[model samples]
Target chain A: MNILYTKNISKSYGDFWALKDINIEVPKQSIFGLLGPNGAGKTTLIRIITQIIFADTGKVHFDGREINEEDVRKMGYLPEERGLYKKMKVGEHLIYLARLKGLSRNDALTKIKYWLNKFQITDWTDKKIEDLSKGMQQKIQFIATIIHDPSLIILDEPFSGFDPINVNIIKDEILKLKNKGATIIFSTHRMESVEELCDHIALINKSNVILYGSKQDIKQNHRSNTYTVDYIGEFRNTNGQFQITDQSETEEGYIRSNIRITNDQSPNELLSILIDEVEVHAFQEKIPTMNDIFISKVNEGTNA
Target chain B: MHNIFLIIQREYITRVRKKSFLIMSIVGPLLIASLWVVPIWLSTRETDQKTIEILDDSGFFKDEFIETSSLKFEYIQTDLVEAKTEVLSSENYGLLYIPRINLDEPEGITFFSGKNPSIEVIQDLEWAMKSVVEDIKLERSSIDQATLDSLKADIDIDMINMTESGEKAGSAGVATIIGYISALMIYFFIFVYGIQILRGVIEEKSSRIVEVIVSSVKPFHLMMGKILGVGAVGLTQYIIWLVLSIMITTGISSYFNIDRKDSLPVQTEQSGVIEEEQENEFVAEMFNSLESIDFSLLAFAFLLYFIGAYLLYGSLFAAIGSAVDNDADAQQFQLPVTIPLIFSLIVLTAILREPDGNLAFWLSMIPLFSPVIMMMRIPFGVPYWEIGLSLTLLIAGFVFTTWIASRIYRIGILMHGSKVNYRILGKWLFMKN
Candidate 1:
């Protein structure tokens, strides 16, 4: 079931349209990646979803109902430009955010303590935000994002400041949240994290969603019918029968090359040709990476 | 509603707990108390005596100059050159030189001192010389000095304001002082606390915490909460200052033994009974003047204008703060809002000059100037209808500015980076939610 959805949403600033008729849905208990290049209206769409800003014309539905003020209590948003009251202590800041998300004071305090301890940042509770390192502040920001345990969480560039170790920690936490049935919508230029964590994705360019679907389905749709084959010996000169896109001699004295099947040939048929001449070490169909697909689609969008 | 309260609570708590707030609250009262108390104490202390030496080359007015405990005059037989040398080198406060001159037209009467003498001293010397020369001229005409002196009776007018009910004693001097003070206090509070609201808004916006908080509450509510929260802080400071000032003033007055009766500089009369009776009458008249001023009404008007003007200006200040990303950007927007306030301050002197004139009447009715000019006119006895009209307009002005400011604030705080000029601000005002 979709937990949050926007229909025909558009936003404009003076003469510039920041977002235009953007329709997107975030399913329950799934990590939804919102992808866009700089100034592609990704932040604007997220702001609309989180109600930090209003959609010039559209409808936002939360849990199958029109979004209302109370719906905000069940949504947590961490904007791309991370900000905290630099003078405020970590513990105090977290508690205040939690309370603003509609948690009672006692509940906020308890949850803050739990999150601080969970992140192993309890010792830094009294330290001001400015005094913490960027990575440390990122951890605190992550904890603040979900401190109130909202059913839907929106994070923009959530991992921008973390080191690799902290990144892994946050990734694990996100997976844990997914396990606990929390829906997440995050935007980032880091495709690796999206590939690792996101189950669904949308690629927006120039105020329009050019591509969107489940992660597997979107990747599947972009894949070309090409395969890489590693073999011990070279194939016979059957250039007309089969096509080798590119070939290279490996250091292990094996011939490795990418091949595209012609004449509606199946993988088995292509394999049959290779099997007769040499020992087939490895063979696999190539699926496009998110980074390649993102670049190609954005370029296609710009060209069109 | 709950989110607004939460925002207010956060704003109030964070600000009240700040070290700056505490320091200002404690130190502001002491500063104000000293401003009132120190001057009075210093002026009341006994001052040293001064001796004036007169070198009369004319020698016609030898015994004319009199002596007082504070100012003593001595007639010395010396040439102008010797006296000039002595006066410049010696510690004498001043030297009075009377050169040989005609009594018909007195000129070249120079009083030399190391520094400029006080206006009071100059006026006293002028009065004594004029009277002595006048008596000599009258004697030349065979007119008796006694008759001339009797004819020089000083006229003292006791102004009484007549109303339909009865004639009440009135004093313009006291009323003008009170009016000036009341108007100035309103100006001070609005300027100080209005900028406080601006800074608070700018702090929230620049820090980027405004987005997180506004996500839970309406932007208008957040703006109102912040403006009201800072106003509360200002009110808190004012209350503490008022109480501390009262305490300090009373304490200092008693410590200095400033008895009203003893402090009254009542000039002695020829008859002791008349002097005592006159003193009692003056005391009663001062009390009666104070009683007839309607202090409760003035205090009520003062508070009403102070809060009304503060809210009006504070909302605009908050809007200006929201429109800009930093102080540098805010400067461009701040001028338009502050111009009216500054204009009101500039015109205050004009209002004081003609408290009952057409300019004062109209300016007092204008919502922006009403808070200041109206208060200025209040002590000088303004009509009730004018006060009511000014108040109504002031409240209406606050509501109008707040409505417009919140609209601008709702859009401005969310906007980051871009030159926010007047055109953009106007566009933002009309932008849909």
Candidate 2:
């Protein structure tokens, strides 16, 4: 079932249209990644759902009800720019933010202590926010966002200012939330991260979705009829059903050449000719990487 | 709501815990105390001896004066021309040339000093000349010594205010001075610390922390909580100062039994000088009488006005804070809110000298000005209608400002990098979607 859905969502500020007619649906228990470059209306769409900002002409629904205060209580949001009151004690500020997210004081305190201990920041509880490192502040913000046990989490650039280890740590946490039946929508420019974590993604370019699918399916769909074959034979038949796209000589009197299969020919048929002509070493289909796909699709969208 | 409490708690704790607040709390009362204490100390404290050689040309009196508390007067019988040279040659202050008293022209006493005489020297000369004039007058009138002595006694001017309603009659004394000092202390501090709250909100808004917090709480709750929390911190600091100042004042007063019985009165009528009609207007009398206020009424009105005015102005300040993206943007809005506060203060002290005046009624009825003016007026007697009307306006004004502030708060806090002005704020308020 679709948990969050928006159809033809549009917002404007004076003459500038912030978000054009856009449609998206985050399905239940799915890690939905909203991927876009900066200023691609990703934040505007997130804000529309979060209700911090309103859409001039649109409708949004969470769990079949119109977006409202009650829906906000069930969702968690971690904004890109992290902030904590610098003068406040770390523990106090964490508990305060948690309670503001709709937890009772007792519940907030219990969760805050658990998170602090879990993050190994228990000794730093009395330290002021200004004294904490950026990663530590990010950790505190992450704890506060999830303390209320939200069912749907929206994180914007959650891994921006973190070391590799901390990034992985946050990635694990996001996965854990998704494991427990939480629908996650994370926006980021890190395409590699989308491949590693996102179960489903919708690529938005210039306020329009350019591509939408699972990571594997998207990579598969973007794959050209290209294959690499390693054979101990002379590089001949440059003009044939299978034409050499790249050729590089290998050791042991072999040629490593990449070929593009003709539309009518199967990979097996092309391989049989190479098998009859020479001793085959290796044959592999060249699938496109998400990086190549992202670059190519963004360029294609621009051209269109 | 729970959200407002959270906001208030955050603001109160943060502001009160600041080192600046603590330092100011300890230092402010001491600064105020010095205003009164330093003057008295300077006047009564004894100084080193100074002998003055006054070369009086005209035959005024016999030569040598007795030593009184390290001061002695000496006279010489030199002619005006020789006295000027001798007085300049000697280390004396100057030569006073008093021509014969014609009784038709004001005598111009020439003080021929190379340098200007200090205020002490000027005062000494005036006193000595007064004694000479009195002696001459007594001798010419054939008055007895006892009558001359009685006539030379110092007389004070006392102003008494009488109400037509026969409610009470009074004059300024130590209590009145103390009350005015206390009321002014409250006024200045409230003005200072209340702006601190506005500044604090502006800082948070500019720094953009307000974005993360307001997402979960209503803007109204946040604004209300912040204003209340900061106000509470100010009150805490003030209460501590109040307690410490009273203790110190009481301790010092009892320690030395510092009774200022010789304090300059409301008016000192110089016996020989004529009075001007314009100067005798009863307005100064009314104000001087008000300086000594009824302790109960004065204290009550002060507390009420301080709190009511603070809330009224503070709410608007919070609104201004949320309506602008930065301090630069906030400036466009500050003058409108602050002008009424300043005007009320001026009108209260300057224009509305009489509580029964029509200007006072108009100023006291406006909610923004009422808090400040009513406090000043209540020290004088205010009619029940004036107080009731002012309080009603103050409360109503607070409600209206809160509503308007909320509108701006909700709209402006989320916008970034945009210059918010009357045009946009006006448009935002009218926006329904």
Tens-digit lDDT track of model 2 for B1-433: 8788878888887777789988988887676566556655554453345556665534554442334443555666667787777877876656666666553343766767778867766665667566666677677789978887787655556645565544443554433344345446545655676677667777777666676776687767888888888888878888888787777665655554555432222222232122222234344454555544666767776777777777877877877777766667677788888887667655644533466688877877888777666666665567666777788787888888777877777777666777777888888776543
- What does the interface RMSD come to for each candidate? 1.7, 1.8
Chain B structural similarity (TM-score) per candidate: 0.79, 0.75
Tens digits of lDDT, candidate 1, B193-273: 788788878888887878677766788888888878887877887887788778887798799877665456565343347
* Native-referenced DockQ of model 2: 0.41
- Which residue window of length 10 is worst by lDDT in model 1 chain B? B262-271
lDDT of 2: 0.74
- At residue B73, give the lDDT of candidate 2: 58
List, residue by residue over A165-207, the lDDT tens digit for candidate 2: 9999889989988889899998888878888888888888787
- Against the true structure, candidate 1 reaches a TM-score of 0.86
lDDT, residue A205, candidate 1? 95
Clashing pairs in 2: none
Residue-level error in angstroms, candidate 2, position B1 = 0.6
